[model samples]
Target: MANNLQIASAAYIVMHLLTKKKQSSIKKRRWWTTQIFRSRQLYNGTSMIRDLNFHTDSGQFENFARMSQEDFEHLVSLLTPIIAKQTTHFREPIPVNERLAVTLRFLATGESYTSLQYVFKISKQCISLIVPEVCQSLIEVLKEYVKVIINTFINNSK
Candidate 1:
């Protein structure tokens, strides 16, 4: 009985030591480790802006959005005044061109706000506010254009 008790105590100590040794040898996987963090830091919102290379040989801008480069620029010019940052407390004002481009991309692609947040590097809340505001500005600016299109449709039908 005495010999068995000694063997059991020795076995328990050995198992504990072995378990501690294994734990010390095993490397921990951490998501926020410097190596993983550096890789994730490489993502920038600026890179999310879609290609606007109007001068490129492929004409990707026009083909993708069904609008000429000039028309897009004209639209941006008109909306800039209305959508430009009026006053910001702490945040930097988003550039009018960026705002217009993001709104246009959202409208053209029908992308959701969450996707746009990643693409534009802007917050979803900001995007939610921007899309409607820009659309309203567009409606206000294009009232005349809308009337022309409606009249043209009516006249063509007649």
Candidate 2:
């Protein structure tokens, strides 16, 4: 899970989109599902409510969404040229365009890998491999943008 204060601006934007998803999902969920969640809780009343692990929204929601849609579009535009160009050797370069969309769908829905296999018409293992590979590649690819933000934050504090 990402620390709220430390999330890159891009990640924060993604989290906001996630919040809207979470609310809709909760509303559509069956009553039995909510009961299961309630039973799992060890609660203290009066603002001490706690839920396990990261959901679509976490501390990021404590702040209202401040970034505008234009700003978000600008960010994605900045990231739009995401083609990887390496050719040391390859019988097959990953067809990243299709892979990225499928992985994003999985992340947004939290759908199980088995479910994805049927949707993607690939084996479960391939789906599993593509997801992590996408994650690792995104981390590396976004390092410059994310690191600049992080480093500026660190320098500002001192």
The residue-by-residue lDDT of candidate 2 on 67-95, one tens digit each, is 33344234334434563334455223334
lDDT (C-alpha) at residue 83 in model 1: 85
Q: Give the per-residue lDDT of model 1 (tens digit) for 51-97.
A: 45665646777765567777877988998878888657744576666
- Pick by lDDT: which candidate is best? 1
Best by TM-score: 1
The lowest-lDDT stretch of 10 consecutive residues in candidate 2 is 44-53
What lDDT would candidate 2 get against the real structure? 0.51
Least accurate 10 contiguous residues by lDDT in model 1? 32-41
State how far residue 38 of model 1 sits from its true place (Å).
14
**Model 1, which residues run further than 4 Å from truth?**
1-51, 86-89, 148-158
lDDT of each: 0.73, 0.51
